[model samples]
Target: MYKDDGFDLVFSYTFPKCDLDGSYQAVQENSTHKICVDKEGSVLTAVDKIENKTLADAMDCNCLRANLIITSVEKPTCEVNGNYSPIQCRRGTCRCVDNNGNQVCKSSVCEVAEIDRDTLKC
Candidate 1:
């Protein structure tokens, strides 16, 4: 159906079945044209329908962004004042290190700490 409308391609991906109610009803009957909804039931801006590229592009971009977010966030063990806990580095700015064979979150700048230690004077 999409190909006849000049769409480059349509995805056959199936989203985990969500309860259909309220605003979620705005989602179309077609799975390929599914809307990106947040946990709060609001549509995500990155996947919202737009001109030119429109539905397929928005859905593809949303899928890519979702995959990137899922893969980029790493759960590293963090230690604060000798107490250890798992922490997710979703922002990509935080750094965790294994100190004494135990992973610990650095109290200072993560990026600077990632630099090779031998090159630094201190």
Candidate 2:
């Protein structure tokens, strides 16, 4: 379904899920977000969908502004059961030291793998 609701074009959220298509992928992830080129792709802008402290503390605002994208703002949901529990460090703390001595923790409360240094961030 295409509509000229004011923008150049509009694509439905169910756009093709192709990893190789760049521009379309961005637009799919965010219908309002556009793909613009500059002397150096000079902007980075995407609303943060995750609410982890590390990202909030370390994200570079300049980069975020340059590559802006209309990220899906809908917060995620968690499937719970009678025995369901939030992901925790092995010791139940927020963080743990990995074999490499890097602090390991559940990047997201719903995640299962213990990511080290944000590498496993969902």
**For candidate 2, what is the lDDT?**
0.31
Q: What is the lDDT of residue 8 in candidate 2?
A: 60
The numbered model that scores best in lDDT is 1
lDDT of 1: 0.35
> What does candidate 1's lDDT look like per residue over 18-95, in tens digits?
445533322232432344444344554323233323443423222322332354454333222111222223343333
Provide the overall lDDT of each model, using Cα atoms, as 2-decimal numbers: 0.35, 0.31
Model 1 clashing residue pairs (backbone): none
Runs off by more than 4 Å, candidate 2 = 1-50, 68-122
TM-score of each: 0.21, 0.15
* Tens-digit lDDT string for candidate 2 (17-72): 33353322221123433322222333223333244334333332322222233255
| Number of the predicted model whose TM-score against the real structure is largest | 1
